[model samples]
Target: MTEVAEICSELLRIDTTNDGGGDGPGERRAAEYVAGLLDEVGIEPHVFESAPGRTSVVARVPGDDPDGLLVHGHLDVVPADPAEWRVHPFSGEIADGCVHGRGAVDMKGTLSMTLAWARENARRGARPRRDLVLAFLADEEATGAYGAGHAIERHRDLFEGCSEAISESGGFTWHEGDVRIYPVAVGERGTAWMRLTARGVAGHGSKPAVDNPVAELARAVARLADHRWPVRLTPEVARLIDELSRALGAPIDVDRLEEEIRRVPRAAALFRGVLRNSANPTMLNAGYKVNVIPGSAEAHVDGRFLPGQRDEFLETVDRLLGPKVTREFVSFEEAVSSPAEGLFDDLTAALLAEDPGGRPVPYVMTGGTDAKWFARIGIRGYGFAPLFLPPGLDYFGMFHGVDERVPVEGLEFGVRVLDRLLSSESSTM
Candidate 1:
């Protein structure tokens, strides 16, 4: 097999930063690079650009069976400042036995493993048990509108027979004493990115203003920020707690979940973010100048609700902001869940086969991914990007953190695990 690290370093050198805003340089260069790599191995690649220079690449490698498994990763990384890093963020430097770069862990590293594995398979004339639909997507750091969303909306036929998908955000090693716990994400919290607007009569600097929009919005923002969201565990989270309890050989009291979690901090860390609904005031805007009380004020909130808690979450937000403020969605996407029985077992088996010391568990992601977009088309997605890291590596904190990097050995381990999973007959629908 080809050196996955070399592919990763090459990819990281290409700066494909998605700044959420539309104006950043798009993923065209990276998409072309990915296309060329696949083409070199004789795998026909289909490249799509939703807008000018916003590109995504897709290819279907035929297998022994007609059933398909979609393996995907985004080509973009969250923007990084070069001054804040030990190495330049865009320079895909290999140092201290790790690949250091912006997208090393956030996604491009995983894409490298996929690309290298696929290339090796193609070169050897090897085929997976199930057809592999490889998608190197764009815009996942934002809303995936130019990536998975566009593909699903305009070109649904690209993923015709695919029933399940594996993507970013899971299958990494989480240490629990001697055992390495690998959490496989079966679901994720729904996104309710909302924009709140408050309107009041314009007023002078020193005037006694009763209906100050700024004050009204500030109070609402504070309430939303400080309000304690009740614990509402969905099926996936509940299952995770149960699995952890068994794995650790300690009972977890659901009623006293906060207290119980304190005892098993390591296991609790896995699902702490998805235990309840969360809303934090991310951005606030009120007055143009300090003196004048603006007629209108607005704020943006980052809100996430557990699966099946959307109605209750929205209702509570409306009540907290009161009658003065009205809210609209900046971007809204539903929570998604896939069965953790069949293909999930296949994933577990693959991981265990690769590393006997590893224990596989199901988890629900706190943040959203391209999985939710693909869920719209009845495709179940799982977070199955496998990586095995040495102890002391803060894998979770490096998602978009400074000095984001992935261990070279971890990428190699992932390649092996992926090969085993794809070769399994049970992977087919």
Candidate 2:
């Protein structure tokens, strides 16, 4: 089998689901399998178990320069609903020329690419200006507490002598008239997962009561969804937009732009979603029966904030919901700082070399990842899962959607681009 095929098969065979996290993040089988390959290639791999079953493996590619580079990816994937997938989530089935499985595009495909590149480099006795670190982590779906987060907190020495790193993120295709500029992800939004408690007096459902928490909670949820935050343009984001506009050979007028953004269907649909502070009430709890008016209601929200905008975002949400709603943060991760365009140009070259007709663009990730945690320790990461998604497919919607599968050629394209970038002088890593 080819490198992409082999790694894809290996990843599919291991069910590193996050549901097994309590007993350890369930990456033991996957990590061990990856270790075997490293051993075969003469690279001593270090495997650590955060919990009973959650295992993390780290391997380094010896380089010419003393400066070290770390390429990290999560082994654990979010639980896949078996009933929803066309192929068995763990079957590693290659149908219609594409590998079908959980974590295929999320990061596993990228991991496979990195592994194959490392092995080939080692075999050729090829070394770069810096050492290369490959970390296959566990427990990213929930938090990095057991994975990359743990590595940074517990094994700080593991990343010693490293100046730069690249991970799965920030690089993807976007159509803007005629230009296809690949955007190397420079930053991400901060993550805030919060729980809110709404309290009121309980009463009989038959008797109309005013102090019902459920009613109050419904109002709060509506406002959270409908409310919009003011747009704050940061340098990187503005540059990304400007580059895209320039590449398309279109003029951007800052004053009427907001109106244009709100009116233009395609541009509005894509850019507006992740532009500002966002609040989503994903889980809710209230009365158990159909007749009772619950005294208290509980709900959890997945909120994201731009860099340095957390304080304002929380304040706004609090005010909009009124004093009845009290919130507590379950987890808080800050937005990461992004690198400049020079690195991105190298990525564009990588993409062009692989497929000359493909278009790449910069994006502002509306979600959070291990990249949030790595920023503090001086590591720059991006959300770069490269693919040639069809126009009508809605790439963003596929993440938690049913039948999530990547094209076979898209995977190959990404592997080739990534490998080319890794070996080039232009790549910061």
Task: Give the runs in model 1 whose Cα sits over 4 Å from its true position.
Answer: 24-26, 424-429
Error of 2 at 350 (Å): 3.3
Q: Give one digit per residue, the lDDT tens place, for model 2 in 66-126.
A: 6776778888777888887788888888887677788776767777877776666666656
- What TM-scores do the predictions have? 0.97, 0.88
Model 1 agreement with the true structure over 1-429: per-residue lDDT tens digits = 237999999999999988988633749989999999999999999999888878999999999878788999899999999999999988999999999999999899999989978887777777888988999988999989989999999878989999999999889998877778899999999999999999998888798997999989999999899899988978898889888777766778889988877877877888889999999899988888778989999999999998899999999999999999999999999989998899999999889988886788999999999999989988899999999988788878898999999999899889888888886332211
Task: Give per-residue lDDT, candidate 1, residue 163.
Answer: 91
Cα deviation of 192 in candidate 1 (Å)? 0.6
Worst 10 residues of 2 by lDDT: 420-429
Task: Specify the highest-lDDT model's number.
Answer: 1
lDDT of 1: 0.89
lDDT of 1 at 121: 78
Error of 1 at 325 (Å): 0.7
Report each candidate's C-alpha RMSD, comma-separated, in the order given.
Answer: 2.2, 3.3
Off by over 4 Å in 2: 20-26, 176-181, 202-211, 252-270, 288-295, 352-360, 385-394, 424-429
lDDT (Cα, 0-100) at 393 in candidate 1: 89
